[model samples]
Target: MYIDLAATPDFKRSLFNAIVAPRPIGWISTVSASGRVNLAPFSHFNLVSTAPPVVMFACNAPDDRHEKDTIVNVRETGQFVTNLVTWDLREPMNTSSFNAPYGVDEFELAGLEKAASVKVRPPRVAASPASMECELLQIIDIDPVGPGDTFSNVVLGRVVALHMDDRFVDAGGRFDVVRTRPLTRLGGNQYASTGELVELGRPNPPR
Candidate 1:
């Protein structure tokens, strides 16, 4: 079966997202300048750099009038928090993804406890396995691919502080990924869990 994207662009777009498989969920928390807190998830996110410790998340608006709360909040306040989602917090993480009004706080809506971030105004999810406090470095506007203008705002932030639960630390001095069971976005309404472990080492060139 072959499908040409030009003939069915929307379906192919969704199909490609599903094919990508197991993308990390950036459970982002942010605060409005007026102090309202918001939490949302972006599968289109990852650590872009490590030297200065930078992270990036993209917020896509449904339309021109509806800007994602996380994007607006980060732009308005210049701060955000990336809370790592785990199996225990899966339900709350999903709850926070609901499309509610801008002012509605997902923390309260999802019944999640909030912890103050050391370097950012946005609070972190207390139940999350780990969190990173970020200061907004820049926001890049992405050009649209289709018809009118499907815009997404990409935010690059510098991590100022990090929080990790000592419980996840093992005797080997490594964060235990198996125990955390982090949540991953699969595609449309689907999600995945951290399953088996596979270790691979870098290949060396012939001497």
Candidate 2:
């Protein structure tokens, strides 16, 4: 069936999310200027660059009038941590996504412990397999099309420091994705784990 995204009814709910299947969950942690810790998960997240190791996550406001706590904190402090969510940490990751009151510490709300970060003030999830400390590069705001629709803030950050569990690393220095089993997001209330892996090499062009 051919669908015109701009003309489709409830396009975001009907097709956008489902079509963008199996997105990586960036379990982001940040601290407010007043020292309150905030944690949330964003499915609209991915690495956008490699030379300086930049990653981006999109935070959608519930309405045009208000921004999410994570976005507010990131604007105030300019630092955040991206914690890799593994299979074992899925439940807590879900818990942290709740819309708690502003300034509430989600780490405590989720009953998870925090590990001190090296390059950023924001703490990383102690149970996560890997965490990347990042400094804010920029934030781009996407305005809504209609009057009641929500808007999104695209945040880009450069990785300043990385923390990884040595157990997940191979002798060849390759990080084992299959072993980590990261939690990924699918449509609706569905979720997936990276337990299976496929290997393919780049094809060479004929000279």
Candidate 3:
């Protein structure tokens, strides 16, 4: 059935969330200027550029609170790290998603080891297969739509450094996605892992 997002399709939980399909999870970690650490997971995140290396994630205000710890910490220090969540670390990553109080150490709470980043104050998850150190580039506030009436802020960060697990890297020095087995967020409480692969040859231009 054809439905218009602006008028036809209702802003229901199933419609909006499922429409986005499986989104990559970004396990973000940040540190306050005073050295408080915070970690949280976000599904509304993706790589926006490559040449300059940038990524963007959306952080919404907590359901019953003002804002999330990650957003507050990034705004305070302008730096954060995006840890790639794999299937193995799914449980601990979920633990870090709780609406904990400010200054709460999610790394410690989730029983995850923190590896100090080379250029950022926030530490990366040592168990994660990959992590990107970033500096806050921009923050855009999105107006409320409907249903929950929740607003979100998009944060764009410039990646300054990247760390990857040696096991996931090939001898040629390239990251192997299959070995990484990154976890993805599905609609509702569902989740998925990296599946099979298919490659197609580039079509030649018409003469």
lDDT, each prediction: 0.88, 0.91, 0.89
lDDT of 3 by residue, 1-207 (tens): 766566743545565567796899999999998999999999999999998999999967887777777888889999999999999899999999877778889999999998989998999999998999999999888888755656789999999999988988999998998888889988888898988789799999999
In angstroms, the error of model 3 at 101 is 1.6
Rank ordering of all candidates by lDDT, starting from the highest: 2, 3, 1
- Top-TM-score structure, candidate number: 2
Better of 2 and 3 by lDDT: 2
Instruction: State, as a TM-score between 0 and 1, how close model 3 is to the true structure.
Output: 0.92
Cα distance off (Å), candidate 2, residue 182:
0.5
Off by over 4 Å in 1: 1-10
Candidate 1 lDDT, 69-172, residue by residue in tens: 88889879999999999877889988998988878999999999999888778999999989999999999988777654478899999999989999999998
Candidate 2 residue lDDT tens string, 9-123: 4545636667898899999999999999999999999999999899999977964338999899999999999999998999999999988888789999999999999889999
Evaluated against the true structure, the overall lDDT of model 2 is: 0.91
Candidate 1 global lDDT: 0.88
Backbone clashes, each candidate = 0, 0, 0
Which candidate number has the best lDDT?
2
